[model samples]
Target chain A: MEKKDKIYEGKAKIAKLEVDESPNTAQKYGIMSIPTIVLFKDGESVWQGVGVQQKQTIEAELNKVAS
Target chain B: MSAQYKVVILGTGPAGLTAAIYLARASVVPIVFSGPQPGGQLSTTTEVGNYPGFVEDIQGPELMDRMRKQAERYGTKFIEEEITSVDFSKKPFSLKTSTQTVTADSVIIATGASAKWLGLDSEQKLRGKGVSACATCDGFFFKDKDVVVVGGGDTAMEEATFLTKFAKKVTIIARGSEGNLKASKFMEERAIKDSKISFIYSSEVIEVIGDNKVDSVKIKNNENGKEKVIKIDGLFIAIGHKPNTDFLGDQLELDKGYIKVKDNTKTSVPGIFTGGDVHDWRYRQAVTAAGFGCMAALDVERYLEGIF
Candidate 1:
């Protein structure tokens, strides 16, 4: 999506959270599970899923985010 | 047409590989899927002394690798792939991996369970460096040294008991009162009878203190709202374990997130079987997991014969 620039941007970011890290910061924005991916547009979550997901499905989800 | 194997085993842990050994010896070809953790939980562990037949202590990963080699010697083919999904609602069950889909006459699920740990930086930093979850695996390393076991459940009691055989002193850090043990009366009585064991009830581990290895633990007393430090050489997390069965979906019956199997290692769905930590919560030892794995493979072979 970032390359195509069809009003769609998709980037995979990985963050490692240590145990001592505050849960408040991690739980904010309603993240309840580990390895969660949240799709946001205009600072609002459009879709959220946890664990490993297919690239095609992620692309489809980005379409929803773009619309 | 290439004849499909009689059984397909998921996971390459003691359970899966052991099953392959038995099935291959019984003239059944077993194809094993070496999941993300090829050798399962034991791979992450350092020393494994409790597993029988190893007169001299063996490295956990080395033991598993030898098991894999032994299974392969019996003609078991191993494929390194993570099962993305599975379909057990029909005969000749199908499984989807990251790259391919495979169908087998029967499937054995031995994905095993992962130890649950407190999300602490120090804990992660000290993993395999004095921070361990399996007392049976690492307790001997801490002989005559003080160690801390965290949790209020039966697993905690069991681990503390096992550690007493090696540790000079074993401290149980419970999140509740001493009287609030989740273990049965027998286990609770055993724990109380052991003079080497001490209960730090109503306390939770806030930080694991050490440099390259664990030297002490910072604990918070929930009842008094006070913090204190206890010196210990090792930390054993007995909180709980989560079975790796999320990809199983609703294809098989589950009991509290564990795969449910009958006495014969047969699941509710025919031609599909489960064993090891994935289906067992009572005993999570490697020997028990391997025993169940053998049972699941034999059961899969029988199931296939009954149908074909």
Candidate 2:
């Protein structure tokens, strides 16, 4: 999360956690795979993408719900 | 108007990222969609031993991260979106993703393959915990422990045999009538000849029972319709795999379910190329997928040269 672009990181509500750190949260997300990011808009989940993604990719997805 | 790219690559597993790395380096500026499962089968994989180049071992997710970063360093654009539909019927192929419609001069299909699961709720809940699909990736974790490999096909026989290296005992749950297995004679005989392997015919893994990690599986005898639970350290589901090409409709040629390719990575459609497990069924190794990715990227470079 720290490595993300500064502007994107600044505006985003990010929660970076290990699978072991939050087993219950991981279960609720149905994270069959690790390193998945679920984006939320207006307190509702909008999108989720699994695996290693670039900072720009994360920013684009974050922008979709920034309003 | 939809955004247009010189090249659009789908799926971000070894194949997709590998291609991105090459294309980015060549200044193609390819746009890649990470798909629903970004890292493909490898992300869920705990450890990988056979990918080569690494004398020590590496975690699956870490390897994929390195691949993605390498591509990012070279100007490859990535989108963490899944493509819901594609239209290869005309030039500048139209792809409808979850967010926006995009067009590309060239498309690379590296969506890869997904392992088939027993679809049990417990099985889904404990995927990375103790139940796995690849014996090559997670077998070392259960060294000297008892494990069970479920299936009766060639893949099942292969997984069971591979599990024998680490597991003290490898129980094969052949879901068929007694003494009638689905694996080929060679694979079946190999498992039968291995001293560490045992067989339980006419049984299916009804449930993967465990608290945190997989502790055991509930097996149902297909003949008598009775279920029994056995203690084990790990459960390997070797039923089979289905290629992730359903989104393509029929715009491309397919062999069975996998995309068929001829002349290296070139698909039936000239401008569209493919690599990885989406077209390959013989070798599903990570190294092999990466090699295919390299090929697809080179082919894309050459195709772009001819066009632009």
Candidate 3:
């Protein structure tokens, strides 16, 4: 929780979805794997990275999109 | 987004997390780069009955999550970054991810291994739908259904045997005759003894038939070029695993693609050490990899004393 807060830190919001519980959302996004991180800006998915990603990289992307 | 660290570990599996736990407890502050599969192979597995310490079997993902949190509790910094390349020619080793580069005084290569897949378009298209690599991970989903495992090796035997627990029938698609199976005698017998398990010799899966999910598999016989379709609820690929060392870029010695270690965890190059499946293809177990991680951490501490 602390790590999550630090990564977002009011710069953005984060939501996690379990693909198994939400098959429709997974199919909508064409997600084929686990641990995929998608960044949405202005209600549109602007950047997406599959697999585990570093917080720094995520934060960097968040900054870019937030700007 | 570049930073420097005294120690950097390039995986987040049992091996890397164990190394981070040890190094962090010693105040080394190891920065761990959680590669593509953050928790590595075990996370994709289902029941881990052999990892020890638990009264009952633990779910593979839960165990890995506990290990990761344990490492984090000890102040280990985890980055969800897959290293793209490495430069180990100098004192400070440089590792590059897609978005940034970082340097470390000492690096631990516990990058682990990835499962191999049949290179077919249909197979790629239906991955995770019903095509899977770990039977223990996906077998429960196939309860009372028919499943096909492709391979003739020990892993294939193991997967087929495990799948018998859930699948109504488990079939092994082998590329060779029963006499020439790559599985050990014991493993072959274990799988053969199961009433629910069957074998198709000298055959290979040519295509995975699926739309939203796996429906069946197209198999071809190598001897007479006859192809057949088998109805199955799931497909499990158990060919083998390849170590994740492509990013090392010839910086260290390799033995058949796995990092070659001379003295336990010491790789060919100094200041660069390895643990887990990246260097160990023999055991390839979570506990053994974690043990190797501890050894590498201790080695890193000693090497740092000599250099720094």
Top TM-score model: 3
Misplaced by over 4 Å in model 3 are: A1-67
Tell me the spans in candidate 2 whose CA falls farther than 4 Å from its real position: A1-67, B119-149, B153-172, B176-199, B205-236
DockQ of 1: 0.02
Instruction: Give the per-residue lDDT digits (tens) of candidate 1, residues B1-308.
Output: 23355688999889998999999999887899888767998885667889999999999989999999999998998886788798888767788886788888888999999888999999887775678877876575676888889988888898999889889999889897867777787887888899999898889999999885688999999998999998888899999889999999998899999988886588888788888999988889999999999888777767767842
* TM-score of candidate 3 to 2 decimals: 0.82
lDDT of 3 by residue, B6-40 (tens): 99999998999999999999999999988877789
- In order, candidate lDDTs are 0.81, 0.86, 0.87
* Best-performing candidate as measured by lDDT: 3
Ranked by DockQ from best down, the candidates are 3, 2, 1
lDDT per residue for candidate 2 within A1-67, as digits (tens), equals 6545455655667767576666577667555344567887767778776545555577788777774
Q: Would candidate 2 be rated incorrect, acceptable, medium or high by CAPRI criteria?
A: incorrect
Candidate 1 clash pair list: A19-B119, A19-B120
Candidate with the larger lDDT of 1 and 2: 2
